[model samples]
Target: MSSTLVVGKVVCITGSSRGIGRACAIEFAKHGATGLVLHYFGDDETTKEIQTLKQEIEGTYSPAKVTTIPGDIADPKTATTIINAGVSAFGRIDVLVSNAGICPFAEFLTMPQATWERTRQVNLDGSFYVTQAAANQMKNQTPQGGSIIGISSISALVGGEYQCHYTPTKAAILSLMQSCAVALGKYNIRANALLPGTIATDINKEDLSDDAKREGMIKRTCLGRLGQPDDLAGPAVFLASDLAKYVTGASLLVDGGLFVNLQ
Candidate 1:
């Protein structure tokens, strides 16, 4: 049987230069999303990487038209720029993956107010701003609806030793996704959150590198492993595709069954 390709769909992913964001970009391209707005932030080296990623996607995959937008999602204006870049390039946005975020390990006592505020700015406020911008465009589009995906984490449901600030922001994102689901449903837009567990991404480099911590995590996970960036691609694709047409205000956990180990 032939598979249905999202050939005409446009997907905008924040923090698409590397890790899970980059993986989602490639996954979307592989599945035939015609227009892609890859969002990222950082220095010249990072910019070049994103450019290369764009090239790779267009060349290796289905030749999906890829555009790169760079900015800090913490800035509301940056969020506007991201959504506008996609609309301006594709004429419409069919799905949005609000995936840009930061998580630095800091003890609550030692973590300054600056760090806490910055975490909130990027994780919670940023998701809010980006979702607002995307929802606005989605509502105004001729077809009048799209998918809004919030990239949350397992820490959102369970507290972490050093993520006092980081965990709350992710929890807020889940609530925000639910809010968007109810508010935007009238316009046919759906909102949902994806929670990834112990993914071996750059953000977790320090933790994952430790033998004991790594072994502990692996042991806790029923799947007996840490998740890879590509592990999230399938779920992200489903949330952004018609397969999830009736799914909204839901949080899907992609954590290798670790959560159930809450003993």
Candidate 2:
């Protein structure tokens, strides 16, 4: 594929202020995406990060416009605002990355209702809302097509001791992509899932802080190291680019072989 696979394209990514989403945002700009709509949670820390990200992208990748929107992904209205912002600024959205999510580690038996519901609302419900909005825009746009990438996790395929509430949401994201792929094929709108395994992100910072536990995870990967957010950025770029024109309803694992390291 060419270096500028996504050149001239406009991309939107939710939860782009940090973690995998942040890395993907930078990669997209480097790959020649002309416009970026970055969605972030409206918190002081993330708000600052989003501002910094905007400057970094626009400064480094000159002419690549960046628009940052702060919102609660779990709120359905937020999805509308994000998609609309992209269209208003860039004319149309060529790629949608439903990456906003939360995973509060807790045991299933003792998990509070609020924690479970919040997880589902943000991870699953948020994806549904954003994807629906983007699909509609893509369907009615001049080009009449776009790529939708859902950020899922290896937990979708396997169970985690403290991720019972979380895994279901990730699993739902994968299923949503599969269904969307079939539903939007005629419109040329591709939907797919990217599942990462044990990526070193804020969500798992405390969990990985334990040296022994972190080492255990690293040992499980064939790469002999924990996955980094940048590790998933290349796969994300491919999915959004013409390189993956024929790819839809697919689940690409960017797990550094951890998923297959069963012993």
Candidate 3:
């Protein structure tokens, strides 16, 4: 679909301070999302990034529109505040991307209860809170609906060596997307999950810097290359736009055929 089709639509992206979230926000803006609610968590540095992005958008687009909201998605009140800021600033929310997540690797035997709780709080609980808030806003919109995109991981589907605590939260996200899709279909709001494989994000580079580890990752993938944040941006745009209006409760895998090839 053409980018013009999504013109004037507003999109709220959580955890957009960096990595995949940041890339998604930029891509959405490029694809005619008129308004952007850039949500960051506990970071002052992101303010500068947001400002830079806003300037870039303004320079590139006819009329750039962007708003930044800082909050912890784990808190329901904060999530509500994010939704309200989007509505108050942009008048409406056309798409909500629940991308706020934390993945701290740990062996099941050695993982502490606190670690598990923290992971779930940010990944699963945060996703639920944000989706709830966005769905409420979307239901009341003149268009009477919007798209909700959950940023899940391929770890949700298969096992990883040292991510027991993190994987389950992602698994919960998939279920959350399905539940929301079923419950909100009547309201015309679509909910779906985007499952990305080992993308070259900063979080992964720290551990995968070794050649052996990097080689192993590439060997496992049918595409023979690690995924990039930009690689998944188009799919996200598609899901958010009218192009995927009939799609809901489905998990779209952007994993370079790794899962299928492994199976």
Measured on C-alpha atoms, candidate 1 has an lDDT of 0.91
lDDT of 1 at 39: 90
Instruction: Identify the candidate with maximal TM-score.
Output: 2
lDDT tens digits by residue: candidate 3, 1-263:
32665678999999887788888887887888889998988566877777777777667765548888887888888799999999999999999999988877778897899998988999999999999999999999897999999999998899888888888889999999999999999999999999999899876877788899999888889999999988878899999988898999999999888888865
User: Which stretch of 10 consecutive residues in model 3 shows the poorest summed lDDT?
Assistant: 55-64
lDDT of 1 by residue, 1-263 (tens): 21345557999999888899999988888887989998999679769989899889888876589988888889999999988989899999999998988898999888899999999999999899999999999999999999999999998899988999999999999999999999999999999999999999999998789999899999999999999999998899999888889999999999999999877
The best candidate in terms of lDDT? 2
Query: So what's the TM-score on candidate 3?
Result: 0.95
lDDT of 2: 0.94
* lDDT (Cα, tens digit) per residue for candidate 2, span 1-263: 22598999999999999999999999999999999999999899999999999999998986799999999999999999999999999999999999998888998898899999899999999999999999999999997999999999999999999999999999999999999999999999999999999999999999999999999999999999999899989999999988899999999988989999998
In order, what lDDT does every prediction score?
0.91, 0.94, 0.88
Number of the candidate with higher TM-score, 2 or 3:
2
Q: Model 2, residue 201: displacement in angstroms?
A: 0.6
In candidate 3, stretches whose alpha carbon ends up further than 4 angstroms from where it belongs are: none
Full candidate order by TM-score, most accurate first: 2, 1, 3
Ranking 1 against 2 by TM-score, winner: 2
Q: Ranking by lDDT, best first?
A: 2, 1, 3
Error of 3 at 39 (Å): 0.2
